[model samples]
Target: MQKKCTLITAAAGLVLALGAPVVGSLPAMAATAPTSSVAAAATTPELGSGGHVFAHGIVTLTSAVYDQGRISVEGVITERVRDVQINAGHGYQAGKVGAGGRFSASVASDSPTFELRFGTKYNAYNFATVESVLWSAVAPGTPPETPGPRPTLTPLPVPADPNPAPEPQPQPEQDAKQPGMPNVLAVSGTDGGWTNDFETGAVESLFTAYDHARREATVTRPTDGTLHVQQSSDGVTFTDRATYTAGGGIGKFTDIDVTLPEGSSWLEYKMWVEDSSGRKSEAQKFFVQEFPARN
Candidate 1:
């Protein structure tokens, strides 16, 4: 009876195993199907170099902040020549061929320094170079007039519900003049004197008086004429130090070096001109100031 019972139990277990489903087999099939599909789609495409071959690969150029960066051809050659020459304007040249090949060089930190151009042509290929690339910390294509440390801004405190009315504008300062003054010419720092020839007359007037601080002055005359002005420590003595002539009415600029006497405090200037009609114009004061401390 015991043997018969054991045989019956074994046969029942085998029947149950054949009827039940297999666990974890479905997950294996699902994973392998997607993996094979992904592998098939990941094939790498081959790149061709056409007739010309680059041994190091393609060159790329880029810039940072306010700079113009470039990549040009460079390398040594045995058969054909490969040379770069700079022209008058910012120009350049580059190429590769025959027993020689091409290389690439970046624009160094010292930019706007040299022009560039290519040498003789070995084949029908026409190679050309690029022009100037300007850079600065402020903006692209803009250079700073003076280079120095960057500036930082400080925030101001805001008033709480400040309902302040607008203040009245102040009257402009009256031009100082003496009695019987004739042929008055007015000049100011804010005026566009640097680009105008009036600076000549203005500078000349300044030098004829007193130049306390040894500051240099430049005067560009109208009709392209230039006059240098120098003055003695005592306001009485003045000199027309030098002059430069140009073709157009827009005169060239001349620099005037100042040499002041030690311990001088104040300096004054006056300018006058005589016309062909024997009429002398009244003298006009140009610059007056106290001497700055010596460094």
Candidate 2:
């Protein structure tokens, strides 16, 4: 069942994800975006030596450096992108998209991979983009260029759902799910948030869950890779939790049902995917805060 109770009910729950859909293997050079985009500009990621320059559409990555478990990257985007976020599981770094659409972000990670998310006002619903990247270390001696002159910061906008469509609705109770179960629910939250992570490429995953507690959280990318999971107590640190050995349904390998650990509140959990070979996807932070018992 989805976990939806909170000591205090949040203004509709906020679930954010940082990672791309799983891929069987990195592409040779660059390929097209996997998820078909409703917007003409959207593209699938192409991972390569170009400093993880996959989604070079609106926000583009140009350079990357890794030192002492820290991975740093630089890129440029249209001024529409207000800020850049680089999440590396254990730690994350944030930088603002400056004038001329230039920005840089760095983070510490046990691995040299991360999910890229940005904020901008020009897009509908304060539109943003998410990209998955595998970065390399900077060669000895040569210096990486920097975007001189500190960029100014702007507020990240989260569009208001003044009037959400009342079509597909969630169950009045939580949607409990067992590990490895397929999620066929067509639900979006009253105030759900989403991005194009690696799972279901280009496919928009709107929020969907009822009050307090849902166990079925799904990812659709990496249609063939075996799904493994990692758990975090503080949303920063994570550890090996479980793996899904069950295969997908007749033409679907995108089901990712999230199950909370015993004795744990959904609030204290953060999750990401790992392939059979140990390659991990970006971590998604979501919680269906349980509603307190009413008197």
Candidate 3:
């Protein structure tokens, strides 16, 4: 039997596994802006001689959450050809993540970090912020390269309903999950204030559960933006809960004293952001658990 537990609520409205449809009016577009110049963008890395090639081995890439976490990342393999610039020939290799849950990339460079990148502003929710994992070739005719722990900092304390017994509703269809990535829950205790080293890539914002006692959360962003916290009762319709602003080019803040809706013991919270350019980011959702309480 599944053990029923309430979501630990936090200030930034970070839920564990919940989602809400986007609503409200769109922001106004800029009036008259100057035309920006376009440069030949380097989408992939350039390859060169004396670089590391893929030996007879397999390099596996795993998702932080699940397989179908709605997250699409590219494994970038780059090598320095010239003294300063890395752009040259096929010095870089990039490949799409296969449906069979394989993140195999044949790197042609001697030194390459198999980094996962989701182009700029392409937000990733309910996934890992530090998406890149490094791999080193073992030897010829050896087993495929084993993946080490992806460099991921701790996530902030996520929020959920404080009340234990809220009325339940029909659950929605779950997000598609990768085959290798399975859904599991684990709880542990630790001491100290909440801390999370957030990573940047395809994920613009992230919410994680740290300590259940503190009931607080911290949000960090690379650019100036506005963070909005929202809550939901049925895990479908959500209303505005709070708003925060990060001025300057970057922002980092921690929120406290987050309260849930009256008469609702089971609530799921999510967060969304608007960058300085008024561009909205994808919402980050968390999990919500609603099950029968044991007598």
Candidate 4:
């Protein structure tokens, strides 16, 4: 009976020890729940960009420049953004974020609203974050002023000459009379949007012929030898699509059954002029976007 009592006492001590472990494990599990929650909260990332105002009145915004609020998970930075886009006023620019997530864009005005976007890869994948900031909130600058139209000139009347000089004999036939304002409206060509250096000679009066029914895009240019028409869907990389040799000043290329991609609304056209003497003019690019439908 004494041996049975001693055994019962020892079993009670063992039960107490095991019971303490169970109680202790309860607190540990509760602690683990909070620790997991805290770990999850710690991994949540924050994204922001830095803006700088230059003395020349330009406001520059850069992504990944200042990484005060950036976050990392398991030592892997989650907010190292790749592509960055900035839109301000009428201008929109896009580029990839460089090392340290840095990409910069110039704002058009002071206190402008900048809509910034950050992505995970270069010009692909979904955006990681979208952010906006008012220029006034960061650095104050001036908005551009709208200049008035230029003044028109009035020609002075020449005094009547009592004896008008005889007209000189007409020289050899000159080049065809250039149009005062050519019917060919320039979308873009030499002396258009690209630049003003007519080093080789300007390829003027670039026009387009778009057949809505047939979905055709025709481009024309004047003062051409062989006009090379290049097309670009993204406006970045242009590929030479067709070449037309011109016998006269006017060079025209018809549809020839070239169509844009499905649901593609924007197209860019560029022209390169090559003369008989092998002289080539500077290339010019033109952007074409669809107009909104009328109500």
lDDT of 4 by residue, 1-295 (tens): 0000000001111122322321111110000111222123322111121223222211123211112222111111123444555554554466444553335544344332344434332223223332222322222222222359999999999999999999999763233323431122223233344332211112332343221111123432333322233332222222223333222222344334223321223345444444445554454544433222122
Over 110-158, each residue of candidate 2 has an lDDT whose tens digit, in order, gives 7655555555322223324333343444532344334499888998998
- Model number with the top TM-score: 2
TM-score of each: 0.16, 0.28, 0.16, 0.18
Quantify all predictions' global Cα lDDT against the true fold: 0.27, 0.40, 0.27, 0.31
Question: By the lDDT metric, which is better: model 1 or model 4?
Answer: 4
lDDT (10s digit) by residue, model 1, range 1-295: 0000000000111112333431211111100111222122322111111211111111111111214443222222221235433322343333333332232333333333322222343333432221111111212433213348988988988877678778899753344322322112322221122211232213233322223223233322222222223422222232223222222122322233332222222223333433345444443444323222233
Q: Model 3, residue 74: displacement in angstroms?
A: 12
Model 3, global lDDT: 0.27
Candidate with the larger TM-score of 2 and 4: 2
Q: Which wins on lDDT, candidate 1 or candidate 2?
A: 2
- Cand. 1 Cα-lDDT: 0.27
Q: Rank the candidates by lDDT, best first.
A: 2, 4, 1, 3
lDDT (Cα, tens digit) per residue for candidate 3, span 163-201: 778778976345432233222111121224433333322
Tell me which of candidates 3 and 4 scores higher on lDDT.
Answer: 4
